[model samples]
Target chain A: MDTPLREPTYLILTALAREPMHGYAIIGEVAALSDGRLSLRPGTLYGALDRLTDAGLVELDREETVDGRLRRYYRLSPSGASILAAETERLRRNVEAATARLRARKAQALTPRTAGGLA
Target chain B: MNELERRYRRLLRAYPPDYRRERGDEIIGTYLDVAGPDRRWPSLAEAADLGRGGLRQRLRAAGATDLIPGVRLAGLLALTTAAFLAGFWVFAEQQLPPAEAGVPVFGPFVSVGIVAWCGWLIAALVVAVAPGRPARVAIGVALLMTAAVPAVSVLAGVPRPPLLVLAPMVALGVLALAVDDGLPVLARVLPVTAATVGGFLSYAMGVGAYWGAYRGGGGEFQPPIGTVLLLVVLLLAIGLGMRRDARGGWAAMALLTPVGLLNVHLLAGAVDGLASGAPRPTYPTMVGVALAVALLGPALLPAAVALRRRLGTPSAAAPCPTCGRHR
Candidate 1:
């Protein structure tokens, strides 16, 4: 993907990275992964899944019936995993740079001021 | 089905029937899994999301996967057409005989129209060079200036171009602003250059035709060869483009809509004149209707193609023989 992946897309991919999961399971995982900062509605989740599936970033893993209702499982593709890894690296580097800048600023602030001729 | 399931199903119906048939069960199942046992209705946010999703799916089903590309193409063609027409109109206005004495033909409205055309020309150049937000801003300004022509004319009681002519130019300007990013510089420049040359040729040919008629003692006027050649070239280009991509057809339609509108307006005027027993009774009602149908063809062709594609595809709408449920 040339453009940066959107937050929901990234979270969804991360949720699917561990194992193939059904729609509801992926939604729950995404919420947990985001620490409840984000919630995946069924419509929004399915829409992203459709786009990912079309882009070959995600694929149908299986379909089964539980409690007389159909459930379809989806898993991240190899391309999706590699993309996620690249995005993670990119974000990590950005965080490192920001952290270094903050550390330097703190060090500068904590430095002692030299006294003038009066001292 | 429970009340929640039933409501969710109702919301799911917003999708295209084929999509609903394939994904309805799965989508509803997901909603049911998420819903509490006692919950009876979908929350407002969920309903809104479902509605938006369904519309997006419908647009996808209609083969409008990404409208930006098509819109960009349309905008380029539309702006080119508007610039060419405006340039030609400005040139053609100069050919008219001067007004009698102090009674000016169009008064200050002509000057205003010229300024608007200049704005369009500048906007075209901006699109070729600057693009992005700059191009959009230029087009927006040009559109406003162009729209002001009729408004000023109406207020000042001066003759103005009919709304039929001015409307498409304004629409084209809006279309040009629909996307901020621009095409390649060559892509943007070539069309504008071609249109400028075409406009010049049209003006020269029109003047030559007028002079020829005047010199030949004026019987029936013949269509200018340049105009005929231009039309043929335009049709050929569109045909070749359509052979390559579907966007070409849409672009061609966008380019031709103004011409279509003008033709229809002219036809209506001729019909009215004939009914009122004017000197020339060339166009009949049948001819007008035929022209109207021809005008409608470009607009209808895509819808027809989309419908055919939808019906021709074997969808999951059919119920399974054994299970008696849609697959």
Candidate 2:
């Protein structure tokens, strides 16, 4: 259960958690979901897919021919879902920490006056 | 289908053989669907990039990050083989003379047999581990060294022990084959063996003459002195290279150990011959030795380091995965 959550792996796991999708579809969805922040180069995409598939966090749901081209659809396995939940919790904690730091900075900035009157 | 298939196959070449056999077609099929028929021929750069990608895939499949570690491992194995062979030869020689009442049966046989064994081993190792360019250089050096052994013996009035040089050359050939990464072991070994034999024959013929009948061209082949000198110098250069590198440990010694031994055989015979008042100062022998040391010493000396780096490095081609070999 060492979290194998590299950026691409995390993104892929997040995408597969939604519904089953083929390789290309997953590529498109990930790009769209990340608003172009994440692009799936073929090499990078396949590598991530292979790892996820191996870890049992993703499973090939079915095979299909769209426009007479073969593609296998992948869905989040139960393990995948659990891992995603853990990742989400981890991310949430990071956000909370950041928020607290920001609030403390704001409070310091808003103080009426400091001893040096630099507030 | 034709365009796609060709491109797919081309890309597939990057993957390791096992991976390609397992899923190359399937991966290509899926790619075709995604890109559709509209996808034009990949530009040269695109193809190159795809090839790199394919390499990465193969690397992942191989469960290894780089080939450097493998090369290091290969060098170690080679060193071990050299040590084992050298030790056995020495032990056999030491034990045989003492035990035998008259003629030492085991010592000569073992020595000769070992040289042949070493040649085959070095040849095999070179072909297996070394690429085309290095393979050629290695084999050439080996053949030259082989001839040098006998030439030195003849000039210095040592016993005509063919096996002394032959065994080490054979060992080196096998060593070469054992480390080959790409070429078939057979391909590397055959050329090396043939070249070694050719060199040996030429040396035997040249030195076997007493500078009387075969003086054709008045001077070109007059004494066969040049060839003899060349072999001696070559042997000396290789010997020096091996010794220098031997300081680096097994890899260095593996290459140097045979040459060192051959030098021993040559020097020992020379010393004995000189002590027994073999001959007066022959111009040819002096000239040959002088020219050999002159031509070979400087040229081979500089290259000694490079040869060591090529043969001595743990893995010369690939960087270490976790940290670069340099780091």
Candidate 3:
């Protein structure tokens, strides 16, 4: 079995899941998706990009020059898409189970006998 | 270049030369794109990332220096496992009276297994020296022999294989298939040292006769718990000292040997018990086998991915010897 994608890899794939993006665009999107929790520095982002490209999970889509700087676009490969989907499903199941348990605990707390203690 | 770009360019030297030639400009461009105009130097996180990224690339490049690290490591593992198995079979053949030993003993299967082992040993040696299509074919045939021994026996109406005997063969096939043949073959000295250490472990564990072939309640049945614990500790050390050793396959093979033994013990017990019309051993051993398989599952995939990158890289060579003569 393949190694499960790490948080950064997952986030990067998520960013590219919708459409191809340049390096800075991916960093911004990853941060936005995480609600400012993940701010990918260029070094980290490019390193990941290079590794991902090497692994065949991500590929360069196009390259254009903006303000005399190279802006290379990358998109998730088919394998990358499936990996992201599988990881998402796993996380969703975990969250669902945790929320279900929490809801059950809350319901138990709302029972009449438990409510009388607060009164 | 401006001062900040110049500084970043200097730091880029830490990356591999080939990598720098390919991706350096793009990296520099990305850094400039993200850098604030007021920023004078790289952030600590950025510097750390570059250091790590560069180091990772360098380490990978080192694998390509002489031998393809992936294939050679796989070859070493195949070689050592064959040697270990061959040595044990020799000992078991010399001693271990048949009356004391039961159906699932080494001597029963050793003949064909020895052939396989010898083939594997030769394949590994070939992989070490030749690094060509023939060596790869030899490795394939050797691994095939491992499964074929048991298979041919069954076709000849022999009793079903002691599953423990089968586990390592299965693992060898799986791992061998996972490692791409395109990677360089580096001859790491540590694997030899690790093999010596493994020999010590074999001697200490009474590896030839872990259980079976003894009077009464059978041979010394030291629970796999100790083996498992030691393997875990050794694995931890491997991880911690990864910097010391670039080829992770040695520790991996060392770990696989015992896990293979434990798996054999568990499955052999079950199969032999069933064949003899006795109750198969219990849950704990099954769980142990399951746990070992689980640990093995995660270890293989990522290494395959990494090695595939090394092997599949267009310029790693003029296409590995499969389609053409060896470079």
Tens digits of per-residue lDDT for model 3 on B175-247? 4433334334464232233334544554566644443432111112322432543355356447645755534
Q: What is the lDDT of residue A42 in candidate 1?
A: 87
Model 2: lDDT of residue B39? 71
Clashing pairs in 3: B67-B184, B67-B185, B67-B186, B68-B183, B68-B184, B68-B185, B69-B184, B164-B264
Model 3 steric clash total: 8
lDDT at B165, model 1: 48
Per-residue lDDT tens digits for candidate 2, residues B219-294, read 2221232233234435544664576522223233334433433243333435335534432334444344434433
Global lDDT of model 3? 0.58
lDDT tens readout by residue for model 2, A1-119: 34636667788888888888877777788888789887775555665666566567777787766655566678888988999999989998999999999999999999877476655
Best by DockQ: 1
CAPRI-style class, candidate 2: incorrect
Q: Runs in model 2 with CA error above 4 Å?
A: A1-4, A114-119, B2-5, B33-38, B43-49, B65-327
Lowest summed lDDT across 10 adjacent residues in model 3 chain A is found at: A110-119
Per-residue lDDT of candidate 3, residues A42-98 (tens digit): 767876776676667887787788878877788888988988889999999999999
Report DockQ per prediction, comma-separated: 0.29, 0.06, 0.20
